[model samples]
Target chain A: MSRFTKIALIGLILFPFAFLLMLSLGKQWPYPAIFPEQWSLSNWQLVLGGSEGLGNSVLVSVLLSLSVATLSTSLSFWVSRHIAYHPKREAWLSLAYFPYVFAPVILAACLQFFFIVAGLYGTFGGVLVAQLFITFPYGVIFFSSFWNERLRSMEELVKTLGGSTAQAYAKVLVPVAKGALMTCFFQLFLISWFEYGLTNLIGVGKVPTLTLRVFQYVSEANIFLAALASCLLILPPVALLWLNRAVVFREG
Target chain B: MLTIKNINKQYKGEAVLQGLSFTLRAHEMLSILGRSGSGKTTLLKVLAGLETADSGQLLLDGQDLSPVPANQRGVVYLYQEALLFPHLNVFENIAFGLRLRRRPETEIKEKVNGLLQRLELPGQARKMPEQLSGGQRQRVAFGRALIIEPRVLLLDEPFGALDAETRRSMQQLLKRVAKDFGLTAIFVTHDLKEAMLMGDRLGMMQNGQLKIYGNRAEFIADESTGALDEARFWTDLQGLKLTK
Candidate 1:
């Protein structure tokens, strides 16, 4: 990158983070000061200390996101392999994009009655299902490009070398696609982690993820706590992106 | 011995392989020369069991192999492009078949190391496929195919992507490896010189049918092969030089 471009890119990232940190730390800035008049860590402490299940909410968000990412990514890998070369694979891919393109809040509204009847509404599982309905398609779309004739040829090579189907997956397919799979996993995790509209509608204020907590604090007019929760909400993906840059992209 | 009889295949109403038939004795190489759409690859794929022939009998040592799946058929097809397993290093790629068979580590090591040496890639056992040159990748692929002691090895234009010097060296190495392993091999290429140089017996494929020649003289004598025309042109040019 050129010097000016590098500076601009860093500024674009750090500036928002700096603004969020300031908002989280400030008691009342009230503008025209260029800095907070009063700063405190009380909001941060309150969220971290687990008052009204804040810490529990964070844990729930992490668990749900990780589970969704793992299930969808792993499932997509196997599913894409099977359907990739099918004569109707393009038609199937078009169907996969449908769930992703729909408005999540609207989809949630339509699915809410089914969830309530199934005894899933106001439950953790309800939130998980709702989020998965949105995120799983992303996984499918992410992996669709990777399942090609070249990969199939690799599978064939494995078979001709006396390896079984299971052996081909274990030895060749997984190893060759490991990097791309990891990148997809992280992406799905980010999608699930930051999801809000569907989680709110499905959970009905019963399941408390970090995004929900942020919204709750905002509704209560606690700006500092809201900002603090928002920062926490965004941190994992940022860290993951940085880690991916360092590991996968750098080596590749 | 390996024999293919009445192998026929069609795709979308177009015949890719039309009653293609051939035979090869043990330790002999048959090179099939053809244009791109001449069904050479389709024939090879049929033998490897990657593609099932619409009608054919594949015989190996007098046993019918038509009912066999690809893995059990003991037929290895090397693609025109070097299809080295990208995740594996040179040694692992070569040892892939042996490891799949659950062979002892010591045996795998001895066999792979021997192949590495013989293929002239002695110091490259640890390099990833991406790190190797086109020639090296193809050699590793050859070793990977040969290590399993397959009944027949089908090579589909294996050296087509290499530079001239690399192609020549790979051809020589292929001949040497086939001899050392006693491999029943079918080499496919569009290059006349490559087909002539690699095969113990040479054949030509046109419109999904194969015509095998008993010798180089016979192959050259066939006007449709382009060899005779090429020879006449060279001869006429030589005469002009003599007159000058």
Candidate 2:
């Protein structure tokens, strides 16, 4: 690619984020004005000060994504291994796709009744569970290809080498799967991080995750606040992408 | 001695091993020759406690091993692939079983280094599995298994993937190590020559049954074992060359 082409592509990719950052700092732009009449740190200040609750939203989103990612990645890894080796492997694996068959919003709506009865509706825990309905199965499907005959043999080898089942996982399988697990965690984290529909329905406006806040500000037509929320929303996933790239490059 | 008695195994209602019985004396390597699906691997897995026999008893030194779990059975099963822990280096791989036993770091280092030297993998301790050649990887695997000092070593076509030259060298190395370590092992292979070359006693598996030969001559004379056929082929080749 030419230098001009490269620069153009880079700008193309970065323009929206730069625009968001600029808009987050700008205010009082009249109609037909390309630039705002005034620019200040007030919007950022409001978010950081917790007055706008954007900071709280950020915290909630981070915590929820982290929990969902960690839980689902680990649970799915264990579950997928069993399913891979099970006699009815195809049957069990097909069920992991069931959640994805319907949209997350529809799935959440379906599960809302159960959540209400279980006293989880309109709560952080409820949203987390709802998000898991999507991310967990994704994790299972993601890790399904990882468990093969060689890995099964490796596990058996560990056993025959005087290592217990736990030791087999800890000493060999888990370490061997470190890359896959990290990749799965990153993907699942993103799934939970940007998740909107399920969080909206299940949270019932109680769990104000950053995604919800972004949409809230957008609907309210508060462009500056929305931009700020959007910036906050992409931070974790961007950081995660950077980290994942570094890991993958180093491994390569 | 390791004694296998009336071991029967079935997969999907089809018998894989039918009343398979064998007696292996201490320090003896019994090589079983069979084609694929001949129940050779099933026999080894059953002995290693990786697979349970439908109705059989595995007696290691006259003690019942049927109830023991695989880890506690003191039998190491090696596959055709080296199956070395890719995350670990040569030294760590060799020391894996010892580390599992929670041996002292000094002891582990000492034994692993010594085994590395014995495996002719000296100065290659820091190399990862991916860095090693196929034969080298197998040697590391053998070192790993031997470091644990298992009661029986069950090898299922351990050198099946190696080139002819490497396979021969590996066979020699295994024979030397087996004698020096006084290792009692069951080496399963499909290669006719490998079965004869590696075994102190030979057995042939056909239709889920194992027939132990009384001696090499008897094994060669047994038509069903294909020993005679292999010998005749080579003889015919030699004759053709002489005639030309």
Top candidate (TM-score): 2
DockQ of each: 0.72, 0.91
Candidate 1 local distance difference test against the native: 0.88
Candidate 2, residues A171-248: lDDT per residue as tens digits? 999999988988999999999999999999999999999989888989999999999999988888999999988886
My TM-score estimates for the predictions, one after another, are 0.91, 0.98
lDDT of 2 at B108: 96
Regions of candidate 2 where Cα sits further than 4 Å from its true position: none
**Alpha-carbon local distance difference test for all models:** 0.88, 0.93
Give the chain A TM-score for each candidate: 0.92, 0.98
- On residues A201-236, what C-alpha lDDT tens digit does candidate 1 reach at each position? 998888889988888999999878888888888887
Candidate 2 lDDT, B82-174, residue by residue in tens: 999999999999999999999999999999989988999989999999999999999999999999999999999999999999999999999
